[model samples]
Target: MSSGDGRAPGPLLLLLLLLALPRSAGRRRAVVNRSIPDVCATCHIHATCQQSGGKSVCICNYGFVGNGRTHCQDKDECQIGASKICGNHTLCHNTHGSFYCVCLDGYRASNNNKTFIPNDGTNCTDIDECEESGLCGHNARCVNTEGSYMCYCNDGYKLETGEHSFHQDENNVSCKEIGCGSPPEMKNGYIVGNYSVQPGSAVHYECREGFYSNEGKFSYCTENGTWEPATLSCKEIDCGKPWLIPHTTMTWDNSTTLWSRVYYHCKEGYYFNGDKNFSECTMDQSWENITYVCEEEELFSNLSIFNETCVRWQKKTGRLGVQEMYTFHVQGQRWYQKNFFHEMTFELFTHKQAPEVCLDLQPGTNYSINISMVALNFSLLVSMTTQITDPPFPEVEFVAVKGSAPLLRLRKAEDQNGPISLYQVIVLPLDLQSTFICDSFAATTFFSNTTDIKGYVAAEFQAKDVADNMSIALGDRHYYGKFYNAPLKLGQEYCVFLKIISEWNKVRTQSCVIWAQIKNLSPSLQYMTAVGLGSVAAVCLVLFLSFSVARSCLHRSVHPPPAAVACEAVHLSTTVDVASAGIASLFLETESVSLL
Candidate 1:
């Protein structure tokens, strides 16, 4: 008013000045809204007043709203118009005074999953959870859709806890191995060792005797029902190279592929102990589990002492008893012979040390005898022939002149009922006497037993052709060798006795077999001489013919025939010469054949 000059009325000017000054908030609260304000001063700075209910009231401005005094809520301009104020794919959320635009669950702001303002030029972009690291653990697959994620186990693996989706933080979901299916089928053999068939589990296989493994030796279970290159197979077992026995040479039918016996022998000057000398290559691809040892003769003081622990292997030399003539011994030998007990009669041709009783005995440096007999009782008679040779020690054993020795044999026990016979015709009658001979020997004894036996010796036993699934024993029970007598001094003779006892085992079976027949195998000198002379005569004839042919060829080459000479006059004489040369080559080959 003062500026307008003229000095307006003082009271009026004072009233106008009071209205110009701003009123305190506390004072304004006390004053009720009874009149309309000339300006927007009664309301918040951003608000205005309006008439309502016949009274002036504070109201929010067009872009702001609230109680109108303390605060002013901003209008969501982004949500107002039909045209999206926040733009496409942008979320509008009202804030304290304004609103913000952001992407939806699957959409991001400005190509990123972040909050942004609309009209600030930000656009929503899809979130790809799959692209993020740590979304899935090992052996898992991840897929993203919208704002969600999913996970799956890789091949050979399954989700843990039957879960179908991936987990974060808690990480409750995981991939676990879904082991391979049942292990490969085994043929000709069976699996052993490991009991599990899960992935990474291993199993071993073994082939039966006389067979080998043609495919996998050992196999393992793998992921996804797959095997890691290992397969199951078996053909026949192969016992590679003989069992490792030092200082011994192996003797086996090398022609055989498997399960053949491998006999061992100590080198000269070395003697066999009770150690193993023979082991069979079993179908399980393993040699008989027997240990062997050899000692030197120097360790033994008196060689004859070994006679007590005698071991022998004998071969046939001849069949003398069949041809020789001798008196009936049934009358004289009845006292000591088994014929007295069994009522069996057989022949014998022998020389003994008794100067009186050996009346018909031929005088000899050493005891020599020949014998051949047959048991009239059995259906088929299995014969076993034996011959002995001088060993590195004194071998003949002599007892007091008495019949106290046993005359028992397994053939008597073979009559037992209900037991299977080891050999259909293997029989040896015992004829032991006080003055009989004893020597070392080795022998193979085959016996089959029921389930009661504690030490099972054989299974699926096979010697030459015999085989079975039942338990059995082969060879000597203690020595593990073929039974035989040793060191009869070649030309010398021996008093042989056959005896076996069938004790507790009523189901036992055994037999005796000959290795080979006796024969005089010496070649005739006359035949050898004749063959040599014939060969020499043929060689001489060939040499003479060769010389004659060479001379004829020389004559032809030096003096050409008239027909060949005529060819020289023609223009094709060189070709004619070549043809003649070919003919000469033919002649040479022909001569060579004739010579052969």
Candidate 2:
């Protein structure tokens, strides 16, 4: 049997309904009740129940969508995109009952958690990897991006490995300062000053000696971390072929550049009469001018020296008995006297086959004689030596000083008379000044005690050691040669003598002069004595000036043209002979000469 709502009922439920229906009489006349379903118990597993209008109702959960009582299912919140649903830089994931927000790569949750639920203002922000120092290695810069960061080298720097960018963990990643390691080398050139590898710096260059350049002399560091190639060019300074000089043969190489030399020598039957034997290439691109001449040699034979002061030479047969004018040039020197020099030239008229000339020469001297005959175009050279004689008298300026030793001047003498060997300074008691002999060697050194106690050798000097106008102090306590210049005794009167000695070829000679006299030596009166001596010297100087002026005037009157003595006659015949000689031969020999 079915119930009243079309439901079949069991016998038990039918009997219960029959018993409850007849017992209601008047109060229960047709009394009936309806049963209501429980809405909470009929809800879906993925849904929840709630109250609505004071009655229980069924609804879907956060991540579910359905008619709550019949069925409920998961709704994909990520279908619309994580950026719109969960927030920017985030991912939306749906669970059975709900959805959550997670950040993407290189981003983090703003809520400081790994995951979050949205709708509470939670979001994802860019993770700043650059915030950590040294994220990029040295010399590199770190930059942040939307979700990441990049590393780059600074200007004027480059990656050591040649990469454009790097990170700190990369092996050997370094940003090294840009450099063109060393500037390119230039031929015959050198760097001028300091240089750096940094961008925009420059290296300067210059050509070395004997070289030059007109091109760029700089190499610059560019922004690309490399040097701009150098453009400087160096070239050797060539002076070109040297100019030819007449009557000479050159010894040279084929180079005509700076400092190159071309040596010159006179050919046969000629003599060099120039100060320089070589010409040099200069920086002005030319060979320097030289005062070089090759004089024609005269025809002479059998040249001989006689009487220690005369020369003779046989004339050429072609010029026999022809009245030829001969010139004699003489030069004298003494080996022991460096200050001595004698030079003279004279003319002689001779018609004899053999010409002879006697010279008035100095003693203890070496002489060279050159004889030239103009007509014959030939010459002869001869040497001679003179025997030693007594040395010339010593020239001195005598001084007398009281209360102090005097500083005396020594004037050097020329070796016109003899070769000067030694100079000696002798100190003696004033009483012995009259007994001093010019040839005496009895004076012992100041340190030596000898029988002649009245005198001692204060100083001695070899002629080579003495200079012109040298000064010597009387008691300076210095040594000259092996003799000590000892201090003088107080209150003693002394005499000083200068002696010159000459020794040559088993002959010895000497000369002497009184250099100074000191009387009543006293140190206390030195300053006062100097003042007195100054006054006397001033008067003497005035007198000397007056005498010199008068003497000069008298000398000028005696010789109106003093320069005439140094003037020499230049023979026109000699010049004509030299000019007429074979100029072609000079050019022929010059063809083989190379410029250097």
Please report the candidate that would top lDDT against the real structure. Answer: 2
lDDT of each: 0.43, 0.75
Candidate 2, TM-score vs. the true structure?
A: 0.40
Model 2: how far is 418 from its true place, Å? 59
Per-residue CA lDDT of model 2 for 1-596, tens digit only, reads 57789867888988998998777664554443234567899999877889999988899887888999898888888889888899888888887667888999889988899989887898899999999988887788999889978789998788878888765654667788887777777789999979987788999999898987767899998877778878888888876665445456889997888999999888787878879988898765556767676667546768777877777778768767789898777877665554566889899998889877889888987766666665665555555778887667778898999988898888887665677888988888899889877766633434543333567778888887788889888767788887777778766899999988888887888888888899998755654575466556555655665565556657667665645323311233343334434332222211110110
User: What lDDT would candidate 2 get against the real structure?
Assistant: 0.75
Model 1 Cα lDDT, one tens digit per residue, 51-73: 88876678877668687766677
Runs of candidate 2 with Cα error greater than 4 angstroms are 1-42, 49-58, 127-130, 154-156, 163-172, 192-195, 267-271, 295-596
Q: Which candidate's TM-score is highest? A: 2
Off by over 4 Å in 1: 1-41, 49-59, 62-94, 104-107, 111-113, 117-123, 129-142, 148-204, 207-596
